[model samples]
Target chain A: MGRLSDRAAFEQYAAQAEQRWETLWSGDRWVISVGISECSIAKGALETYRHLELLLSDGHIPAVLRRVGCAGWCFAEPFVEIKLPGQPPIVYGWVTTDRVPDLLDALRRGELRPEWALGVRAGESWQGIPALRDHPFLRSQRRLLLEQAGIIDPESIDDYIATGGYRAFLKALFEMTPEEVVNEVKTSNLRGRGGAGFPTGIKWESGRRTPAWPKYVVVNSHEGEPNVFKDRRLLETNPHLVLEGLLIGCYALETPHGYNYIGGEHALALRRFQKAVEQAYELGLLGDNILGSGFSCHVRVRTGGGAYICGEGSALMYAIMGQRGQPRTKPPRSVEEGLWKRPTVLNNTETFASIPAIIRNGGSWYAALGTKESTGTKLVTMQGPVRYLGVAEIELGMPMRQLIFEVFGGLRDGYRFKGVQTGGVSAGPLREEELDVPVDFDALTPLGAMLGSGGFVVFDDTVCAVDFARYLVAFSRYESCGKCTPCRLGTPALVEILDRIRHGFGRPEDLDVIQYASKHIIDLSLCGLGQVAPMPLLGMLERFREEFIEHITERRCRAGVCPMTAAAPIAS
Target chain B: MEPTKSGQRVDLEPLRRVLEERFRPRDYREAQELVVGACQEAQRLFGWVPPEAAQLIAEHLGVTTNRIYGLLTFYADFRTEPPGRHFLWICHGAACYVAGAGRLVEFLQERYGITGQGTTPDGALTVHVFNGCLGVCDLAPFAQLDHHEYVGRLNLERLQALIAELQGEAQTEAADGSTE
Candidate 1:
């Protein structure tokens, strides 16, 4: 099923694609899938996959092996799935190279080694192993963006077209008006997933309202902030969904062009998204007069030069414009005067990807899912000492305590949970007391932690707050766009103070100095980068003040992680 | 002077392929839309964005050389100088930091005498402590070897072993060269 030339052509293609998808998914042959995700490759998934490929194709073990994207099962990577004709897909974790033959032998015998099995997809049990629905980590998650990640073959356009991927864009183009689509998104109450929780519909409407000749839509896949892996992974998992969403937004706004501003480090994702773009054009899902509509769409994939500041709206536009990625103050948001002063609607990979779901199920259906203010599920990446160190999509109102303890299976048995740095590097490692707070976009701000990009790195007993604070502060200083005086000057000054404190040369008055500097940096800063530059330090100081005091007065490293020397204040 | 590190004249021929193939911006507006791609291709063709390549980009796009150099300096991905034979990106993301990336970093500095962002003495490797998560936090406290291969669950011993292996490979290469 190639290009849908017209409405009838699209319908025929959709029906055939659905049938093809069904045949492929629940087909007669035994299908073996290994994820080609970065996380999977890191854990030696390729080697296992190669071994499996040889084993499956050798004719002794009759099966087919294909590559898929990471299913967000970080704790158990190199996981393999075996799907028989009648049975559900059986997922087994820790499928190392040596274990491939053993797994095949067991599969041949029509038995699953319950020890190796994580769960069974599409069914309740594979002999003894439980269903994925009953999975400990997966139970809480309302996965909209990551729903088809592990199951679908990310590199295949056929898999996407089969699994109800581009239907929303097609529907929007053929069935609904631009106004209706925009209204649906507005009704869904979907806020921007890329840090700033601005209403996505509002951002789009602003772009639509502007009489700019040519408007642009951006899928900000620049997962620049430290600890945020969701955007890149989402793109890698299913680039088509993101593209479809982008096209939908374009259709809603009647725009011609869209840009996928992918990070430089995310080479695999860039390639996949670029591939998806090519496939879309070939299928006529993208390009001029989609299903014979006047709305012509062309997506350009722009690889970032790895600036964290470019993730900022103005800086991103500036970077795209061949200008320095320095932020000019925003009265004219990207939707007003963006990308060479044209109206541009920029949303993150998560936000754009979620658009399909919102459009498919009307706006009210989405609005009813999450909190009153913060609607819809969020793609959150959990890292550090958590048992399941991966990404999971959770509802907005889910508590931090539940996310870390229940969903992620808490830290390791021996370690005590100290804190968790939610959002980004600028946000906190929130203390144990602050764990009960909801992971809402609006609610997390007051606690000095926002659901910014939805990546929360938990800190166990081993982490020394002062040292961690210093690392984060120094990182901010390093990444500071020299455009702002506060971030440029203040971050380095804060780093110095933290460094002094870490090295055991800190004076008692150093705390006051940090407080004063932090105030100026937070208050005087231009963009979010400068405003939140001192946040990690401030959050650390608020929660773990004793650690700092101990480092200062006693010259003691309580965690024994720091090199605290009882010396005079280090000269700047 | 070191061949790769020194400010010697490079062959500008390969840069033309990257420019022609990757970009085809019709006008200045189109060029403006594709600045990042142009710079990225320029960097990829040459190991780093040399002054010559920057000049070419500026000329091609009808922009100032300052703009190109500004981008090269601003983004952490681009380097003005040519990098070492191999790139070692040690992730210092929050996950890695909590999992003792500091210790591994200290170990590299102490054991191999690697300092800051500079290349090793023999020019075999250069250490890049990445500003953020490289999206492989599953393997925390990890270092990406040669940009693709990930050395997971990294510790002092594993790091030492990895260094020995690289050195062994280098010695083999050197011996092969001598034979040739």
Candidate 2:
């Protein structure tokens, strides 16, 4: 291959070095990348890794074992991928330690066991085996944000570079003016994936136009929303991408300081991101005078003390500033006054992660991929009772029916679909009839639902709507920051009524009180946490009024989830 | 409110020394930046922030002790009372809850005889501290022992096995310490 003469020899040298290293590690020898996720660990995946490594070190196998992050198809974790010379890499799932010998035997014989094989990766289908893209779990997904997940060595910057990473950041820095980059994003119509569906371009423009010096760009990587692990996945599996996006955002907004506030509970993700930050700094992609473009930026990777309100923009800023993570009163929005009262731009983990790709492929190209209103793919976590429960990246506006049935392979076992709590705990539940609704921000908004961070938690026939609603309300009550009266008092009051109804002590007026409280909480709460807290309960009441009535009149919970219905009364 | 083994109140001098070395703040507002940091340091040292820690930090920052306590109580990760040797954080996120994290929480509470989201009676474990989301929804019903290690796709049986394993480890460590 002739080297392109347009670039300097050093660029070519770096590219060749990375290519040679990848080929040496992957192409000629057995390269085994095992998926290291918490799910896999629960299934004794670390033991399996140790066994494999032991075998390799003992000269029983000629292979390399690299620990990678989540494969996303989590139902079949303890996932392993093996690359043999002159052959496509083969992925296998549910790899127990006992199966290690069999796997190694297959590798030695140049044959794959079809029983454990998920599939060869796309464009590399060996024999008659289907491609990974053709797998039933993955077929409907349009994986944009999750493009390199489970396929690359997340720790290796060279591996990421070999797969065409960081080009977008370089292009943004050298080629495009800050205004042009902002306009391109605006033209792309990329909305904030961190709920509210605010246009990213407009948010950036606001930060840019704000007449404040030392503007800050913050990444909200705290995935505290219930059932939402997509941000953690991105941070752990492809941290460099998130870093690149942050760098690109800084370049666009002309901000010199950036902070990635990660959840403290996520130790692995935090460590991975910390390492990626160090790598970026070492590469001169971060720190002062980044890439010698006269544009300098430094990113601080801070960990949150596990407050859900810290996911809120203003609260996140306060947490970064080492204060109590209570929501700030608006009018001076985060864009105008944030992070020590500077003009700061805050975006979610997935939103910032999507920036690099948006810069790489032109704004219009990304805009054309998804629906007109919701332009771009969204990474959604489909957990609870699904056959293949994990995160999937789907083009925005894909029907909920298609996602539930086609992508997730429907609910596990014989469990009939009861309902789903889309977005986070805050968003209302959608019934079986509402499954046809497009999983878009605007479309779900009118239904009193939102695509908030794309947590699609499916419920089965065994789930009691009352118990589930009580659980969500209780969660909100417990997690409320209590800065304002509505959230502090209102959430506890809502929980009390919900708890009373679940305990079969509901007065009919309690329902009205709940409804009244829901409206007022939404109206009076100062922050998004308190505002959206009532939606789940309200949604459950609206859709499953019979469930509430059954609990009240019949004093029977069909799903057998409520304690009072199942047992005798406690001393009250 | 816990007393020392020698039948005296636990000394705050060592803790004060550590805090002084780690963070010597000049003023109250300036110390706001070290609120989370100080709490983390306290957690690392004592496994939880005692009332004395609040007082010490408040004094160091030139703020009211209530302010330090307010910040500590606001963040969920900070524990006030001393925990058992191990902290068990179960994610009751929508997915994990639906995948039986509720059952796990119930089972631990019932089996270990713990209540009110605190340490077990024997101080072997803290059973009922629920986390927001472990961010590993792919592994539903995720559980974390201590603050670092993750155990996912947890059922009661697996949780039982993990707890037993932790108890065993703690026993071994105790034995080693006593011998020393």
Candidate 3:
């Protein structure tokens, strides 16, 4: 591997190497790839991998087993991709340990199982499985961040390199200076997708400026949003991309240590990440002087106990310090004093995953893709009433209506779209009137919603706003760290009032009580959880007050979704 | 692979070892504390009283099982098995019960083969009659399964269907041999 020390030299090397690399992997070899993403792991892909390893112990097979990330067909996991000489690579899904024997038999006999065959690979096609690409759930997706997912073995550096993995990192570290790297990110205008929407370049610069002995970079992989699986899907499917991004960050900041704070409940992801971290260390990509550069960096994995509040930056810092996962008051922001009192820059998994691409393509190229406010692509986890319910990456400022209808196939069963819940539990619910609103921090914030996290839960006409508000509050309340009075106590009161309202209890004044409490909680809370705790209730109240009034005064739920109100007699 | 004797009690020592190895900068004591917290969380998910779950966690954590067990029993969320496939927790505190939670519970009893505090004959549902504020008072009478909210009023038919749906999913996963 030749090294280039500038962009011009790097471009020349890349141009020459692209042709050479393509020729090398085009040779005859048996490629047996398995989707070992978190969902697949849950379906016992690890055991299947072990079985395959044992079965192929003899050299007669001449096959290499590789573990790739998710392929978006979560409903059918443990997908297997087989590439044999003179045959188009094929992918089979819904695989289990029991099915492995059958799969092996078919492979040996050169027979195909039509039922299991998801699709076929046609010369490096993204949609290896034709059916899967046409599947109602995946047809609308335009994969960018997930480009190499389900294609390359995440743990195998060779597989990653074979698919143009470290090329970006190499170009960034060896060719571009730290200042240039930072400048590219600045030009990209890529704001943080982790709720706050802070500029990534600004954060990097701020942390880089500190006179601290050692700066820290943390990948906030601890996704705790209910009904959201975007981050989880990314980490499960493309662990290496996230790692490469982290490595690029390390190089850009000249930091020595990085931490991936995985959610405690995500056992499968933890296992894969733990293995990936170890593999990175073994390959000398992690510890001490990576790729023969004087720069040295190592990444460690930390598991956070199931605390929703810990998803907040301050609380995440607390958990990393081995404290009870609780939020800390900000003033001495994390960039100044974080993780054992060090200058730390914490960005979400997706945020870090974008870094390598931004570096590879240059900032100007990346910035030109999305809206001015929100640059680059955004990975959104679509859930609930949507038909094509999965994760997809779309350009920022894409229309909410297009995302709901064109991308997610609209409300399931053609149910009228009532509203959409963006940014998970803490995000304010937006009505149909706001459906055309462009997705960006500036637009969403004024509408009393923040692009907290890229999680969109669609609701149909059948959904009851009163009920929905209550559900979110209950989730936030239970997950609260109880570090502050507003979140700890105020939330329960709001829950009680909502319960009363939903159960046909009378009191016009109770609405006033809810309004007062919601305002106070949002204003006085110490952290993001408390600040956003009242969002669901207040949003529902403002947008659908008639429903709440109907549940109380009329003793009936128009949606017929609420139990107490549903049982009430219909008006003549 | 050998099973340790029960009287011997699996130790929490290994948890500390694993934690210390993973968190290199942290000392053994700090590692043990972190492991304890993680174990406590795992116990809550299982809906079991912490002591037994803690012992198992101690084994994973490489610490004395007794030490882990002690920590488990200390937490509020940790529960010993009340024994039910569906952990039906109805909020019966001042807010919920006042807002017709009692009627909802009665409705559940009349419709499904459930009691106030026991599992159904087939172990499909376990209706735990407890009291707590489910936080969304403005909307009241709430119930949850494994901490995931199923809010917005409750009725006999909906409760039955919810239970059946959960049981069906569980059975399907089990039949596929995808779940432990």
Candidate 4:
């Protein structure tokens, strides 16, 4: 068999694999596929999986079962997808142990129950899936980030290969030099997706040129931001892409050790990631002399104990050292002093995933795909009142309105756009007036907001700015690591004042107090947490001062959304 | 491995059995440590771990309840609540206090008719306001529910809605037999 080249090669490989897959199905007389993601496990997907395994072992059914990752419809989990030789692939949602027999029977008869079949897959398009494409929740989505999700069996390396996986890594390793690899990334202008928009190549090159032995590459999957789901989806859907990036990173930085720091509560991501790492190691892709090359590196997976502070680079380093996750005063950053006090290059999963692509295609090619300042694609998790509430990989500097109206299918039904809380809770909210601004780090920063983690939370007119600010403040307060006085104490105090004002107890001077506290915390805090702690509240107060005063003076919430205060005297 | 000062012998057998029977079946090891770790964590959160908590851990770990409880008391992360439906955590830590989480805690006490980790008159909600940091300094003044969903910048009104929503959901789930 000749080596596969491109999409054509993939098609050929898919044809062959399909034939073999068909034979296995027809000869076996039964086949089962289960989505074994974290949420599914919690919902007894594993129990049902075990039950099927037992049935197969008992010779009650001849079947080959495979465990895949999340299909993105988390609301209905433990989703099962079945494909028989002559029958079309069908997906069943909310399957439990009690329903295993029915699923098995369906498999045996090659029958798909309409109630259980959430959708049918037809060459990258879905039908009979509740108007999935036109539905408000999924209307405006360009799913480059989630391209392979819910389609490929995440655990199968073959399935991944069949879908053009590792081609980028192989091309990078076999074809490009380390500096060339770095240059391509530089050209791509891919910034760090983990809140800070630090240019990824600069970080990589700095570590590469550090002249330090035992350099380290760290994958920050600690999605501590409350509203973000980009990294979670990436890890769950295409973990191998992350691993491939990590391997490339290890080669580029000449590092022997790599770690993926996943949040403790992200059970699904951790499971899939661990399996991917183990499989890679088994295939000799992760161990010494990978792909028969002289380069040698190994990857390790570490889990955080659900500390939001650990998402910060320094705090993440501390957590990996098995110590309390607290921020360290930085003169020597992670590029200088990181994990075990080594010169470490830390990039989030999304940032790392871009590297292989940059290497495979030239830097300029990747750069040409996006805007001049911000080159390459950015994975933005669109949430809140937006019609499409999932992750999408968009060209950087894409217009905000396009993302809001076209990509997100506009605001939810019967609601007008109030504003958007971009970059998660840490970012300042962007009002409707600022919606036309291009979505990039610099663009958002100039408007008193920032592109932090690419979490675009849409808000409609019904969302009260005071309550929104309060929600963000409360989130920040709970997630603050308490390493600094300002962040530790100032955030809660600000929340109280905001609460008082929202509850009709606000004095006019309270705004000044909040402003002072916001400035103090931003200036005095030890880490990113404190520095951006008051951003949401301050942003709202700055842009929507009338709303705040309305709550205090008239005891009314202008948006008619603040739960604490009464309606604004019925307008008359 | 040597046992800790608590006089609990380091029994790798139970751990190994659980790991083999449940986790290792799918070629997973060390990956499932979180299951065991969660038990120790629950204990740390609640002080005295409960048998049902251990059973829940076992259910997650794919092991027997007794084995899970043994591992729970053996290690340090499991906990059993005395009697409460709600776990209210107050952030007195630096970030939280700076963000006005203290006042929010006071507000909960004053308005909710429930203080600390006590149940409501209808036993529908239990409030547990503890002192800790949740790591969202930027969105400070936050609190968590059963370590799942986080509510930020809490006030009386938000708290009321949150409690009401939670109670309503709990009732609906009880009616539907859904495990939230």
lDDT leader? 1
| Least well predicted 10-residue stretch by lDDT in candidate 4 chain A | A128-137
**Stretches of candidate 2 above 4 Å error?**
A1-10, A565-572, B1-34, B50-68, B103-116, B148-180
TM-score of each: 0.96, 0.91, 0.76, 0.72
lDDT, candidate 1, A1-572, per-residue tens: 46667878877877887897777777778888887788888888999998887766667755678888888888888898889778788888999889988988887888778899889885566578899878888888888888898888888887887888888887888889999999999999999999889999888888889997688888888888878888788878899999999999888888888888888899889999999999889888888887777768999888778778889988988887777788889787778888878888899888999999999999999999889999999988888878887888898899989988888888877888888887787677688888889988888888888788888888887889999898888888888889879889999899888877878888899999999999999999999888988888888898899999999889987898887755654564
Candidate 2 C-alpha lDDT tens digits along A1-572 = 23222324326645875777676656666788898865667677798899889889976556677888786887787888887777777889999899998888876886678778899875756676778888988888898778888877678776677778878988888899999889888988999988878999999999999999889999989878777888888887889999889999999989888889888777778888898888777766778776557888888777888788889888888888777888878979989999889999999988888888888889999899889999999998887788887888999899999999999999878888999887787778999998899988889978877799898789986889998888888888888888899989998899888888888888788889999989999999999888899999998898889999999888888898777642456444
Interface DockQ of each model = 0.78, 0.55, 0.09, 0.07
Score chain A of each prediction against the true chain A by TM-score and list the results.
0.97, 0.96, 0.86, 0.82
Worst 10 residues of 1 chain A by lDDT: A563-572
Ranking by DockQ: 1, 2, 3, 4
Give the winner by DockQ: 1 or 2.
Answer: 1
- Alpha-carbon interface RMSD for all candidates, in angstroms: 1.1, 2.4, 10.3, 10.3
| Per-residue C-alpha lDDT of model 2 across residues B1-180, encoded as one tens digit per residue | 322222235567767787789677665544776667777766777677777767777777666777777778777778777777787888788877887777777776687755437766666677655657766666677777776676777888998888888788778877898999
Q: Give candidate 3 misplaced runs (Cα > 4 Å).
A: A1-32, A40-66, A75-84, A90-120, A123-142, A414-416, A565-572, B1-180
Q: How big is the positional error of residue A368 in model 1, measured in Å on the Cα after superposition?
A: 0.5
Q: What order do candidates take by lDDT, descending?
A: 1, 2, 3, 4
For each candidate in turn, give its C-alpha RMSD to the true structure in angstroms: 2.1, 4.0, 8.3, 9.6
Provide the interface RMSD of candidate 1 in angstroms, 1 decimal place.
1.1
Error of 2 at A350 (Å): 0.8
**Tens digit per residue, CA lDDT, model 1, B75-179:** 888878787666788888888888999888777777666544666666666777788888788778888987778887888788778776776776777689799
Give fnat (model 1): 0.87
lDDT of 4 by residue, A1-572 (tens): 43233434544665676666556556635456787654455456788888878877877665577777765554456777766656556677778788878877865674556677666554443344443344333444444446677667777666776666777776776777778778778877888888788899899989887777778899999887766766877888789888888988887787778989887656667878898888777655667766565677888777775567878999888766545678899969889888777899999998888776677667788878667877777887665545543456777887898877877667657777777777677767777777889887788897788888887667666667887788788768866777689998999999899778776777889989998988999999999878988988888887888888888888888766555543444233
Q: How accurate is candidate 2 locally (lDDT)?
A: 0.81
Q: Model 3 Cα displacement at A171 (Å)? A: 3.0
**TM-score winner among the candidates?**
1
